[model samples]
Structure formats: structure tokens, C-alpha cells
Target: MIKWILILLVVAAVASLLGYHTLAGAAATGARILIGIVLVIFLLVLFGLFAVT
Candidate 1:
């Protein structure tokens, strides 16, 4: 799950960057949102892991 979240976060970040910087359009909004969600999930996982350790 953590790995999945990390992968998603990386994908989202890249997608958002590409969509906005390269493509440029409303499509970028979706990518940005995905990036935010993935980042939140990634942070949650990190927090959970820290708590466990």
C-alpha cells in the first residue's frame, strides 16, 4: 500500500507537471488534483510508518 501510494504520488506529480508545463489545458486541473490526493496519501503512509516505528 505504501509502495502503491508512493508510486501514485510520483506518477501524479509527473503527470501534473507534464500536463501543465507541456500540454497546458483544463486537463491539467485533473492531474493537479490527482497529485494533491496522492501526496496526501503518501504523507499519511509516512506518518503511519513513523507511528509504527
Candidate 2:
């Protein structure tokens, strides 16, 4: 998932450089969403709500 976020960020950067504003915005939004999800999951795990038996 982190890898996917990084890929999206790179894609966004490239798209922005190429002046594909819409594509870049979409990718950036995707990256933000993924990061938020990851952070929430991480917090859950830290609080022992998602413990691995």
C-alpha cells in the first residue's frame, strides 16, 4: 500500500510536470486518501484494536 502511494505520488509529479493538471490532481487525491487510510490503520494497530494473534 505504501508502495502504491509512492507510485501515485511519482505519477502525480510527472503528470504535473507534463501539464496534465487533472491527472495530477487525481493522483494526488489518491495518494492522500491512501495515506489517510494507512494512518488510521496504523493508529488502530497501535491501540491494540487490530492486534495480530
Best by TM-score: 2
TM-score of each: 0.54, 0.90
Tens digit per residue, CA lDDT, model 2, 33-52: 99999999999888785475
Error (Å) of candidate 1 at residue 38 is 0.4
Candidate 2 global lDDT = 0.97
Quantify how close model 1 is to the true structure by its C-alpha RMSD in Å: 6.7
What TM-score would you give candidate 1 relative to the actual structure? Answer: 0.54
lDDT of 1 at 6: 53
